[model samples]
Target chain A: MDLIESYKEDLRLIRRFGTGFWIVLLLIGLILLPWFAREYWVYVVTLIFIYSIGIQGQNILIGYTGQISFGQAGFLAIGAFTYGHLSLLGSPILVNLFFSGLMAGIFGILVGFPSLRLKGPYLAIVTLGFGIAVYQVFVNSEILSGGRMGLTIQKLQPLFGLSQMTTYYYFNFILVFLFTLLSYNLISSFVGRAFIAIRDNDIAAEAMGVSLTRYKLLSFAISSFYTGVQGGLYALLMGYLEPNMFTFLETITIFVAVIIGGLASVEGSILGAAFVVMVPQVFSNTKAFIPVIYGVTILIILIFEPLGLSGRWMKIRLYLRMWPFR
Target chain B: MPLLEIKDISISFGGIMALSGISLQVQEEKIIAVIGPNGSGKTTLFNCLTGIYHPNEGEIHLNGENILRLSPDAIAELGIARTFQNLRLFMNMNVLDNLLVGRHLHFRKNPLLPMLRIRKEEILHRKIIEEIIDFLDLQAYRKARVADCPYGVQKRVELGRALALEPKLLLLDEPISGLTSEEKEEAAYRINEIRGRFQMTILLVEHDLRIASRLADSMVAFYYGQKIAQGTPEEVQRNPEVIRAYLGDD
Candidate 1:
């Protein structure tokens, strides 16, 4: 009983002050990382932030709304291509990225209109088909993608006189921060409550005055906006665009990331994004082992820790607070 | 105008008629108890009113405005809320969140602005939910997840969630059917208090005749998807058809 009371005190302290301190510490580390870390590691971290944005959107839709979407990569491709097309026409990068997200949101609404009516496997199939169809069509269309050879973006001047990589990294960091704050605000508010309500019981939610069509579409559009922004950033970072870049496998990887990170949690998305992005790199020498490793890791997480890596992280914190006590 | 008028509503699924040309007129601030055996179409009537199932041929007017064409949420926005026979209180969420979800209609429609801050609207809505919790005496279980709560508490939470919507008309399907005798009495008291305190019309469907008899201002009895009797509770209970339906023609 005494241990339990002490543990509660520890938890209160963590909740009150420890969390903010850790977040500030993490931010400080990230800020200083680019200056001290290898250039390759900085690039990898940038990619992780971009993917975190996309995964966070997925978490909102899949975790919060209980909607299954396998076509986030399609929106990503749309954003990248939109950026590529507009940038080719001499628009500024910022304007192109903004339009890229806009175009993706429009496409998301288009898909959401028909697909929101589907449930379970049908929804997944429709979204997966959409992802594949977008890739195939873009690859075939000479107007969109130079007929599979792809379009190359010229090296542009870096923002604020920083190196291209540093500028890109900082820009991504700001976006990730803004989106994290936005998602945090959203998940704690009534809108997020509505999403969880719809997810838990649509019939009850509808009877209580939640508009299923409107909220579902809103989730879809906002999620697509996040993925689209990531896509736009990807184009800027890679300085090249191709239909092949946003693959079916990439879509699956993102879905896996959301699940592995823990559904419906912003922290889960970040952890899951980092894990998925880094694992393949770790196994780069043995390409065939990557799929086996991914599958095994997911299975283990599901069987042993249904809440995924973040859930385990939580348990670890609790265990540490209650050390040596049952 | 009657507060709610269901005129000649008929809904059929293939060959089986769920509700057949049933018309009901609900006056403002009245508690009407609908009693029937299982599969007798009491729930179907509530479904039609809430726009879950559209009547094949009928008109539904709430305060003289036709509500038959509206979607469920749109109908809800016009101030009609319901509780299910089987409790459907967002089981994964805590009681507070479930009640907050009931305020979905009161939220701003932009969906973007709320993502920036907690917002004054949420604070205002939270106050409303707090009042509902106080009314329902759910302060003890405010943070308890609905799934973790007992059946009685779950029913209370469901009622509290519906009340949070602040609907002009509340449709309750078997609000106390699964409760213990003590829980039933408490639920009855709350239901009675609700009408006077909230100034809302109520249409309740219950299988418990004794509780219905004591609680309902009026009573409607259903037998085989048809209304056999509707009047003051004593009048409905005295009708031969209602007796035959419940007792099966001894």
Candidate 2:
């Protein structure tokens, strides 16, 4: 009985701390996995990190501010290309990634400024148009985008002095950590509150002295900037760039990731990114109808778990421990 | 000097005229109420004064300068604050933070400064924080979320948020309309105390004749977007146009 009571109390601590506890535990497991799990899982893990960066950007715009952008894949393409092209020209990896992210953000600002005047579906259409335009440019521009042939990037000079699969995993993990922290800090701050305020009521936000147009435009631009930077990192990790890599469906995935992970949540982005990137890859070897299976699974999750898997887990944990109170 | 003056202001929403030519003035440290029947453009006139709507004709001078062209944000910076007819509290935010946001014009810290203000201006003791919390009696429920509060509390909280701006002129849209008798009385007490405490030049739009007469020093009555009467509460209440236009009977 004493041992069982101790065991239950330990489980309770883990349940209460929830996402942070799980993420930290997962990070530890991931850091150790490269030693035992071999090459393929490492690749899949790297993919998860890269996807989280994309989701992080989406989280900023869609989750926090309640703005939808169909141009997300376009922003992703900009990051990938900027990084791939700069790296090809003999620039260092860090310099290329930083500049690429910066350029993508500026691009976001330009597009966001004029089109943001229209709300909701109109704004989504404008961003979709931007995606289509970028797609056209990517297909036609042989010199810049390498046309349909795609650009094969052989190497990226690592984030720090670290190397090998384990090092790469840690590096990507840290990047994801930083992204989550930045997002958390942003949400907790006046700017984040302002975004929620704007989302809640634009008229009231303005009456309360928030500049609606300015902040709306800035939120889009900033969200894109974060996504763009992630794109550059992604190109480096994949060791290639292709027009097909960023599709409209992928933009949908960005939204799906947040919604499924738990919209307006940092941990939700990570969980969504992981599920989106991993589940498909894990079944990729099955070859015949693996992608179809993944799609069905996602639909099931959407139907029954509107708050997403993370939200469901949170409720279950609460139910188990504090049942009567709940 | 008069705190606010609206000259022959007019607004047409597409083909329909919402507010026809209307004019009114509010003196410093006085409670001036605007009473009207529904669709008489009471809210429209308030919207124009607060820069939510731009009048097609004439100008509104705030503190002796035309504020007709100013945006809502610009009007706020010029020391004008307002409460919506429907409460628009940042429901997710804590009660104190809602008021703190109203002190936006005073905040030079940008968004970054609020984090640093605790250390940077250790001496300021967060002046607005202390004063607003005290003035509105929001001390007990400072940390409570606005969404969870009762309606009467939310109403008071909205007023507290507006007063946080420490504005020279406050445009209150029916501050006591939907409240029960007790709540209305509480709001009336706060209105009197606020006026006495802050020396605020209040422009109140209300439908309740009793509350208006008891609280307001003067009243401006509107009919079909036009000012029909303006004088002391008793004088305007006596005006036949006001009686027929807003009072409907008696």
lDDT of each: 0.87, 0.78
**Model 2 chain A poorest 10 in a row by lDDT:** A1-10
lDDT of 2 by residue, A1-326 (tens): 12323322422312344556776887788778777886778878887887887787788788777777788888888988998888888888778878877878888887777544777888888888997788778878888787677997756445555556656687677777677666765665567667887777777777878777777877887788788888888887878898888887777767667777876777778889888787566666775564465467668877888667677877887797787887
Clashes of 2: 0
User: What is candidate 2's CA lDDT for residue A27?
Assistant: 71
Q: Which DockQ values do the candidates obtain, in the order shown?
A: 0.55, 0.32
- Candidate 1 C-alpha error for residue A224, in Å: 0.8
Regions of model 2 farther than 4 Å from truth: A1-33, A157-163, A285-305, A320-325, B109-127, B130-145, B247-250
Q: What's every prediction's RMSD, in angstroms?
A: 3.4, 5.4
Model 1 ranges off by over 4 Å: A1-15, A155-163, A322-326
Q: Which ten residues in a row have the lowest lDDT in candidate 1 chain B?
A: B111-120
Query: Each candidate's TM vs. the true structure?
Result: 0.95, 0.88
What pairs collide in candidate 2?
Answer: none
TM-score of chain B of each: 0.97, 0.91
Candidate 1 residue A92 Cα shift, in angstroms, is 2.6
